[model samples]
Target: MNIIEKHLAKAADLEKVSVGEDIRCKVRLVVAHDVTGPMAVEQFAKIKIEEVFDPQRVVMVIDHIYPASTVQARNMHWILKDFTKRYGTILYEHGQGVVHQIISENHAQNYGDIIIGADSHTCTAGGYGVIGIGVGSTEVAAAMATGTIDLEVPEVVEVNLTGSFKPFVTAKDLVLTLIGRFGTDGLTDKAILFTGPGVRGLSKDERMTVSNMGIEMGAMISFFADEDKDEGVAQTVAIELSEIIPVVACPYSPANIKPVQEVAGTEVTQVVAGSCTNGRLSDMKAIAEVLRGKHIHPDVNMIVIPASARVYEEMEKHDYCKVIRDAGAVLLNPGCGPCFGAHQGLAADRDVVVSTTNRNFPGRMGSREAKIYLASPVTAAKAAVHGRFVDPREPSGGGEN
Candidate 1:
């Protein structure tokens, strides 16, 4: 059995599991944020159960609209707080960071653990070699009610990598390259197991960046494996890491990918460098490297958000916050505010933004008239400096790595 099967087998307490097989497995953790947690708590109430299946295994986060953007949001937060308080489940409040990053850093402790989140980007835990599944609030309610959930084992797609990445060619670039090759729905209902020697070079944060975008390509999960195997594999896609360059997902779809050079000089009004995808300490360091001792373009507004309080502390220790502020960028607290378009630095009409977030759909960050280009932190930082798209590997506009 491969990695996915191994996890399923362990969770099911079965000797083996097969692709397409239906099984009920014990879940190690169930996560939901402010947006989804209230709905799930409401659903769980319908089950008529007095207590959650296991309070320790459940976590609720207040991230998407931290500080409550509206009366409705405030009430929703109240629901989550009341539910967790009544059920004794863990609650992560405002400034804790995005749910996915919180889970990866705090709850996901063991390899091959079966983790579930209400948001699709939960696959971010795949960086820890865990089977992270993104399901709806109803599924979360069921999982919370019984401590178990049903699943159809998915086929595995092996992303075989060769060679090493060039400077400024990050894991975000690699995943964008994969999405470009596979199209948005090409890997629907499948799992991706990254393999080959090149995987050895990537850091845990980089792996999380790659896995976080797996949902964009319709993958069930994306994770790293010790080695490549043909048994129980559905297909294999090979990638040459050295050949990859910084790329972006154009507005309207993650699949609308183009090399950064192809879009050079396209004016951007805003730049963002944080999310569950690329809002780690290393990502901050990368952005700081580009903006240090230099100010961003006078016309552009750059918003830098750290993913969590812990990452924020690390950035402060390293003086990354000072570097970013000196570069004329605005710093916001850790949360899912701007990335989800709920609050904080929302793009105005006709705004063009270069961001490090995972998605680029219309109105994702603000007005439908706004356009967003999704790129790595390095690429986003470069755009902030020049107020336009510029290849991060080139010689102009602090592009040199």
Candidate 2:
């Protein structure tokens, strides 16, 4: 077997490995949010299971309904609270952070292990060298009961990203470029392995952004760097703290990846600079630094949403929030809101929107006629300030100052 097959074999072994083995495969991490936890609880109760395999291994978060967008969602939150409390599950409240952001930062993922969640982006954990996938409530409940879930091993595709991205071009752009090149259906059911020196240059958050959107390409998961080669099969991948750099995905496809100097003629209707994809502090800081004294153009409506309340707090603490607001951008709460068109940053028919969120499928952000362009936070910020897609390397103030 090749590198990917070896990793998959290790992931499979995790289900039956002894607790004391150098490989920690039997241990599993289960995650759920308010939107999916209630259903998971209901399913588990129907199976007549009184307790989960282990409460400490389960993580429940309440960011989906923190301010309670609706009465039904609020009720769901309450049910989640009760359910998690009843099982002594690890519960992360609004202040603890968003599930995705926390999971990436908390050092919870073990290489060669299987991590499952109710959210599709659960695949984001692949950045850490784990075999992560999203499942339905019933599947989640089953995993909770038996401590294992069935999955078909997927074929792996090597996505070799070469050359350094110019400033303002982010991981978001890289993935979006993939979508444009592959047409969102090209890599269906495949495991995308991001390789090459460019892939190694991205930060954990940027890798998360790339892996998180693998679903958009109809991929089973997007993985970065081979962890098995770097550490013991049971060990976790050690992130290089010094090599981390802020990145964003731009709107073009891989075939159309151009230096920032070449995108000076593109036009845009809206510019959004936040989402689970690129809404972290580093992402925001990159945009703020680029848009520092500049104001958003009057023609374009710029929306900036933090990934979580904790991220919001950090931004405010560091004055990045003030910098964004001063630049005439509208800030939104941290949720899957606008990313899915449920609420916030909705667009009109035929309106073009440039966003940092994952997925740009038809009607993803709002109307079917709305055209969604995905890019990095810097590109989005610079576009919002100019009412068009101006390359970040270009001088601010609608081109030349």
Candidate 3:
């Protein structure tokens, strides 16, 4: 069994579970942030539960509307502050970073631990060999109160990667290719367990990117196998990194992927190179490599947000911050910026943005008339310097790496 299956079975005190069986399993962590936190607290209130089963295991992140967008958002932050203090739950303040990145980077490090969050992208924690499950607010409240949640055992799909990434290619490229080939709903009701020799070569940040976007393919969850994992057999597929490029998911749908070259020259209004999906230090280094000495187009407004306060400090210390600023990209304090229509980078009518964030549903980031193309950090950075859709491998943005 994969880590997810093993954790679930052990939690439920079952020897094993068949693929479709519904099992009530223990939740090691009940993670929620500002956008979903208030609703979860309300649900927990409905249950008349004054204290969580394990306050230490509950994490509250004030990320989504952090820096407090509206007065209502400010009030929401206060509620979370009170709840965390009342329950002694771990509270991550605004400017810390996106919840998914924060947990995977700091809190959710134990292998085989089941960390469930109210937000869908919580599955990003699965990259660390934990079973990261994203659940609804009601389920989150129930888990907080009872220390357990029920879930149907999902079909496990083994994705085998078997090649090294070429220069300018990052894990985001591979994920984009997967979503493009499978469409947005291809992996519905399934859990993906990535294994094979190639999988081990990816950095932790890269693996996180893969798991982070699993939901783009409608997957129940996705995780990387342990480095020493020895599973017998299961349904599987293979992908070679040599076949991938700095591709992008075109306007409206994450599944509507197209080659960067195909969309080359398409005008862009902005380029974002951060978010849970591609906001790690490695991602910053990748974009900086492409933007080493070139200034972004005057017409383009480029934003780069580190995944966490720690990451931001690392960038500043290493001068990655200086490099990006020198390249004419504005680096914001660590937070989720315009990834989900929050703030810091809204779009206008007919605006076109090349971003490293996940999900490109219509009206996701801004105006319904605006468009978003999902790509890797370097790809988006390259486009920022060019002010249009262009492959990072191309020569349009200053000199090549």
Candidate 4:
């Protein structure tokens, strides 16, 4: 059995699921963000479900709409707050950070444990070796009440990775390259089992980037193997990390990818360096390494959001805040900033923005008329200072400097 199968089988032994040819498992935890939690809470109300099975197992984060964008948003936040208190569910209030980041910190993945979230990128929790899957608000509600949900045993695909990434190439770049090859709908409903030396070699933080974007290709779940034990899954695709180049998902889609060199020097109006996908301390250190003592371009509007309050404190400890803020970047309290264009910064019509966020679909960054580019934090950091796409491996992109 492959890793996914082994996980499901083990979960079946827990009360989470009963193992049969037809397997449906109980979710270990149910996580929701502000943007999606309200509906789930409303669903819980509709079902007349007043009490959660275990409040400690549910997490609600208010990251998407920071500081409450409007009166309606504020009211919704209050409703969520009330819900958390009334039911005893864990609640991370507005400005705490993105859902995925907080989940990673608090819910360390357990082997074979199944966790799900309302947000698609909840698969990101797989970085810690859990079977993290994303479901809708209704499913989240059900999990909150019963701690169980049915899952389609995904057809697992083995992504055998070889070689290693070089200087300036990152997990984001490799995932982007995979999306470029597989297209946006590439992994549709399939769980990608990452294996091989490449998978084992990646640090936990880097693995998060890959698992985070698993949904970008429409993946059901993306995770690395704990051991070389094969789960009898026949399908496999191998990726050579050494062959990947820094890539950007051009505007209007996450899979419309091109190598950075292919679009190098393309002008950008705004550059953002933060998101659940790329807002960790490792990411911050990478961005600051390139931006040390250098100022961002006058034409560029840059915002750097740490993934969590914890990440923010680490930045202060390392003086990364000084290095980045002094370089003219807006340092916002940890939350999902402008990644979805909720607040903090929004692009103007016809503007081109490069960001570290996972998605780049139409109007994803506020204006439908504006374009968004997706890249690694390092690439985004370089673009912020240069005001255009530049190869970070090039001399002008601070590759050697």
Candidate 5:
């Protein structure tokens, strides 16, 4: 059995399992956030259950649309607060951080643990060597009530990564390159198992960046395997990290990838560097490295957001946040800033944005008429300073140095 099968079998108390087989398995953790938690709580109420299956295993995060921008969002927070109070479930309130980041910092400690969340980026936990699956609010509610989830074992697509990343090239570029090779839905309903010598090249946070965007390719889950598997996979694709350059996903699709050179000089109205995708301390350092001793372009509005409060504190201790702010970037509270297009940094029609967030779908960051280019933290920071996309590796890329 492969890594997926091995974990599933252990969770299901079975000796063996097969791809495409339906099974119910116990989960170590279940997560929901403000955007989905309200809906999940609504569904849980429908189940007529008095308490959650295991309060310790259930977590609710009020990060997305946090601080209550509207009455409706505030009411949603009230729902989650009321639910958590009644059921004794753990809740990370406002200013805590993004849901996936919170989970990674707090709950994803053990390998081979089964984790499910209502948000697609829940796959971010896979960086911890756990099986992290994203599901709908209904499914999350069911999992909360029953402490188990039924799933059809997905066919595995092995991503064999080799080589090391070049300077200014990062996991975001690698994942974008993969999405470019295989269209958005190329791996629909499949599980992507990362393997090969290249897996060792990425730090845990870099691995999280890779896993966070797997859902953009329509993968059910994307995780790093503890060991290499030579068989039982539906397909295998190799990625040479050394050959990858800074790239971006063009408007309306995460798979519409292009080299930064191709899009250089395209004016951008906003630049964002925060999300489950690249909002870690390393990402902040990348942004600060470019912004230090220079302010962003007068035409560009830059927003820097940390992934968690702890990350924010570390940034302050390291002076990354101070340098970023001194460079004319607006530092917002740690949360899902402008990633879901719910609020904060909404682009106007005809606006162009370069962001470190995952997904570039129409209206993903604001108006459908606005164009969003998804890139790495370094690329996004360079764009903010240049007021357009520029190759970070080139001395002639032309930005305020």
Candidate 6:
């Protein structure tokens, strides 16, 4: 078996391994943000849970409203603070960093672990070979109480990305292209296991970009290279560390396969960059490089939001903020924001938005009539400048530095 398959088999084995015949099929790590934590705390109170199973296993982060965007947001933070303190849990405020980043680096997400977060992009942990799933606030609270959560073990579909990515074609573009090829009906109720030589060449950030969007296809979990093969049984379920060629999957049923090049040149009305999927520092740098000296087309409203204050700080430190701002892109905070249409940058009726976000389901980013096209940071930036979906490899009217 190849590296990915080997690790997956180990993950399956760990799921079956028993501690004195008490089979632990679902090993869980619970996560919640300010927006979702308040609700989770309320649910925990409802259940009358005296104490969490493991205080160290739960992570609470206040990222959706850093600078406290509103009175309601401030109250949410206050409630979260009180709740974590009562449970003797770790409460990561604005200073600790975004939930995704902190969780990725946290010791709790070791290989073969099943992690569940209230945020949809929680699957980002798959980059490290853990099976990550996004759950509702109530589900999160239950995991905190029971130390386990039930899940339907999903069938795995292998996404074989073969060829090397062309210049300007990033992991973001690969996922978007998958969505365009399969629409929203593909890969429903499946776990996407990204394979192929192409997938092995990607960085951790790039891998996160791909797995984080498994929700777009309604996938239960997305897994990549395993990291635990060398650490004996303890680390045997971790993703294999290797170079991956960037690729995306659009699993339409169990038989259909399509490539993004087949649907290039599609038109769009808006272009967005940022969001948890493509709001990392590398993603922002790619956008700045693509739109350095160019201005966004008047017809397209380009919006850029960093995933967290850490990402925002990195952009400012690297001067990426100035580059994008000067190019006429509207910048927003680190919250889920436009990805869910919770605040500004809502889509118009029947409008198509080319975004760097994960899902594009009807009404995901605003108007139910609106359509969202997922792409890489580079593609979104280029499209924003050209007023249309233009492949980043193609020359623009005025080349970006």
How do the residues 53-114 of candidate 6 rate in per-residue lDDT, one tens digit apiece?
A: 89988889887666575788799999999998899888887544568876775555566577
Off by over 4 Å in 3: 227-234, 397-399
Q: Say which prediction, candidate 3 or candidate 5, comes out ahead on lDDT.
A: 5
Error of 1 at 36 (Å): 0.4
CA lDDT for candidate 5: 0.89
The C-alpha lDDT values of all candidates are 0.89, 0.69, 0.85, 0.86, 0.89, 0.69
List the candidates' TM-scores in order. 0.98, 0.82, 0.96, 0.96, 0.98, 0.79
User: What tens digits encode model 4's per-residue C-alpha lDDT throughout 1-401?
Assistant: 56687678666553332213566677788999888999999999887866898999999999888788789878778878999989999999957788888988876656767898999998887777888899999999888888887776677878888889989999999888888878888789888888887787788889998899999999988887766535566587878888888889998898899889988989998888888899999999999988998999999988899999999999999989999988999898888888887788988897899999898887887889899999999999999889888998998888996
Name the candidate, 1 or 2, with the larger TM-score value. Answer: 1
Q: Which of the two, 5 or 6, has more lDDT?
A: 5
Pairs of residues clashing in candidate 3: none
lDDT of 4 at 332: 88
lDDT of 1 by residue, 325-374 (tens): 99999999898759878889888777999889988888898899899899
Which candidate would rank higher by lDDT, 1 or 2?
1
lDDT of 4: 0.86
- For each of the candidates, give the backbone clash count: 0, 14, 0, 3, 0, 19
Off by over 4 Å in 5: 398-401
Clashing pairs in 4: 1-231, 2-231, 16-26
